[model samples]
Target chain A: MENTALEKSVLNKRKTKSLILRFMVWLCGILTVGILAYILLFILVRGIPNINMEFLFGEYNSDSLSAFSSIVTTVEMIVISLIIAVPVGVFCAIYLHEYAKRGNKAVKVIRLAVDTLAGIPSIVYGLFGMIFFVNILGLRASVLSGVLTISIMILPVIISSSEEAIKSVPDMYREGSLGLGATRLRTVFSIVLPTAMPGILSGVILAIGRIVGETAALIFTSGTNVLENPTLDLMASQRTLAIHMYMLASEGLPYSKDMAFATGAILIIIVFIVNFAATKLAGRIGGLSNGK
Target chain B: MESIKKSKFNDTVMQSVFFMSAFVSVLAVIAISLFLFLRGIPAIAEIGFMDFVFSEKWGPVNTPASYGILSMIVGSIYVTAGAIVIGVPVGLMCAVFLAEFCPEGIYKIVKPAVNLLAGIPSIIYGFFGMQIVVPFVRDNVGGNGYSILSASIILGIMILPTIISISESSIRAVPESYKEGSFGLGATKEETIFKVVVPAAKSGVLTAIILGIGRAVGETMAVVMVAGNAVMPLDKIALLKPIRTLTTNIVTEMSYASGLHESSLIATGVVLFVFIVILNASLSLIKFRSSRN
Candidate 1:
């Protein structure tokens, strides 16, 4: 009878322990999801009401603080940065995957540099851009300086993702091209790159998202001077959308709070679209590369 | 054979182009390091390294300006520790839940949610902190809205995606054999996970934590918005009071600062850069040792 009683108590303790652990895990999961939902809902609910046609396209007066100029600057930053970064990044990835030996010293050094660059803070990038691009290079805190700084910033993202995509291309395709007496360059360009295009494009989209969302790196390099009219003279000092929202929040003009919310809403919407597209591309890449 | 010779020449040119492109990142790293040290070390030398790093006074405008950043260092450490404290356990549990417990339907919702969290810009996070977290802390936890505690909470939230995704993948990577052996020994699922799987995935979890630290320490705009940017003496620093960090020190003063004041800020950037290099080195060390094992 005493033995039976002890076994019953031991079983009960084990059951209780399992129950508590399960409860805690579930609680953490719920909390994680809940936080994201709350932040998204809170911003969208308050922000969507304030965004109208004028808010999107009007000039930034003391009363209105429109985002039209900032929007144009944002697009220009994205385009210029990509044009400079994409070819360089794609070529880097191709070299890593196709040209370098597995344990080559240069390959190792390149990987380390990429990792270190990615780890460096955006704020540090901002400071470097300020000192080097803005002052030393005599760009003088223009959009061009910001573009140069972020192009370096987003290179690792592009290189790593593009490498992954390139690495996934079946060797059979390469072997066949060479079998047909095609030059290695021709094979890579015609067969491998096209096959990896969806993956590479997805990575480019992710880099775009990073550029769109960056703030600290742009503030000093780009300078937060708002243009009265939309212009794309790379020399002109401008603020991107993230910086615009940051300035609005920090300066806190009377209507700035409402305008900040509107800006935040717009930023979130862009991110959602970017994330959705990247996810879709990633899904498509799986089917394309594997099915072939 | 003229066409063949032309193709060979073209290939040689493209290969060199690719090699040059590949070398750019290495050149960038060397250039960044050289530039930062060249510009930043002068101020450190002028101020004296011991006085700059160890002293707490940060008066850049005083007649005899003090350029010490000890308080900011302390502030960075405190908030990062606070973030790790608040974010790690919850994130670990969430990772385990996703890897071990969540059904397919819920995983679909939770996975995208985490990605969205990662994608949200820091500026938006700053605004969120300003509008929401500051007021909540002001009312509930004491002190003014902008406090170290407020920064900690926001950073903790900001780092969740990094910690969760890395930890979840690591947890999933643990071998099925270990779990099977645990189950064969009459261990419960929870016991098997915490004891068997988690212990196995410790290095990866550790990597996640180190990366989270990197993210939290390097974070600036969100922290600046919430962390009241008060340059405090070492003794006066507290959780509910405002504080400055190394990154914030540079950003707040960079606009108008010139001469030594500006250089001192750059020196602060040097300090931040050192901390990041150390973190990155340690992370690589962890990865190397783990792979070897």
Candidate 2:
């Protein structure tokens, strides 16, 4: 009878401990999710009521230039930065994965440099942009300057991500192609790249998200002029959504406060879509490859 | 012969372009560092390096335009230290909970939520802090709306995702055998986790803390929004008083600044750059040592 009572108490204690552990995990998860949901929900609640089609696709009012011009500039800057960054990032990834040996000193140096760049603060990047691109290159707060600055900002992210993707392509495929008498270049381009395409696309999308959200580097390099839309003239000064929102709050423009919230909502939505799509694509590709 | 020539031609060009791209990417970092150092040297020499660092007055507009950055340096340390004190323990505990105790479904939901936090823009964080944290601190902490405490709270929140993610990965990497061994010895799950698993993952946890410090120190927009922009020092425990950090000082003053004022702000950039370099180097070293072990 005593032995039975002891067993019962021990079992009860075990059950209680499990419950306590579960509760702690749930609490941690809830806190993280709660903070994110609060941020998103607050912006949507405050901003969505104010958004309209005109806000999405309208020209700037001179009185409140930040709202309209910033959207246009962000898109133009993304396009230009991608043009420069994507090619360079992909090429560097290709060299690191395909050409460079593991122990090569130059490869090691490149890796270190990329890692350091990834760790460097955005503000320092802003200073560099101000000195090199804006002042010395004399681009001077133009859309072109913003493009150059952000391209560098996203370079490390793209290269590292793309390299990981490329590296994940199975060695069996490479060896099989070579055994079948295909040239190394042909094998990499046709077999490996297609296999790695989904991962690379995900990396590019992530870079897009970073570029759209960036503000600090843009503030110094891209002077806060709200041009209506991008033109062929790269020298035209422009404002991004983030920079516009910052100006609204910091400069204390009462009229444009709602507009800033509206833009913030839009930016968040855009990032969410990109992140969701990239994750889905990568997951699908991963499943298919593993199944094969 | 023609086909062979075409194949060789393409290979050579592709290889050269790929190699050059990698080389250029590396060169970009070296070139930027050299440029910043060179451009900043004249000003540092003019101010005397010690004065440039230790001076308290930062009026870059007056006749003399005092360029002391001591207050800004103190402000940076205060906010960052405050953030570390709050963020590190919560993040580490959360990471431990996720890795050792959570169910699979909960893990999936929680991990992505952390990722989402990381994905949110700094500007959005700034706006959130302005609307929420500023009010909370003013009412509860007995301060005005904008304060260093407010900035620190916001920054702490922003850095939580980074700390949690890195630490969780490290904790997960702790060998399962260690936990199993403790369990066999009649240790409770909590005891095993605290004694064995955490000790094994100590280096990784250290690395996460370092990364968190880096994030808190480098953060600009959110800190600037809530830090009250007051250029003067406050009295004892001045949560309500405005403070300026190095990053904020540069951002706030760089617009209308010219000549010596501009140079001094650039000097702040130099100082910030050096601090980041040291932080990153240490982080990398920790990461290297941990991975090797």
Binned by DockQ into CAPRI classes (incorrect, acceptable, medium, high), candidate 2 is medium
Q: Model 1, which residues run further than 4 Å from truth?
A: none
How does each model score on lDDT?
0.92, 0.82
Residues B25-90 of candidate 1 have per-residue lDDT tens digits of 998888788888889999999999999999998899998899999999999999899899989998
* Tens digits of lDDT, candidate 2, B32-74: 7887787777777888887778877667777776788878888
Q: What is the interface RMSD of candidate 1, in Å?
A: 0.8
Q: What does TM-score give for chain A of every model?
A: 0.97, 0.89
Categorize the docking of model 1.
high
* CA deviation > 4 Å runs, candidate 2: A1-25, A62-66, A228-232, B234-237
Please provide the root mean square deviation of candidate 1 (C-alpha atoms, Å).
1.0
Instruction: List each candidate's DockQ score.
Output: 0.84, 0.56
lDDT by residue for model 1 (A155-194), tens? 9988988899998898899999999999989998998899
TM of chain B vs. native, candidate 2: 0.94
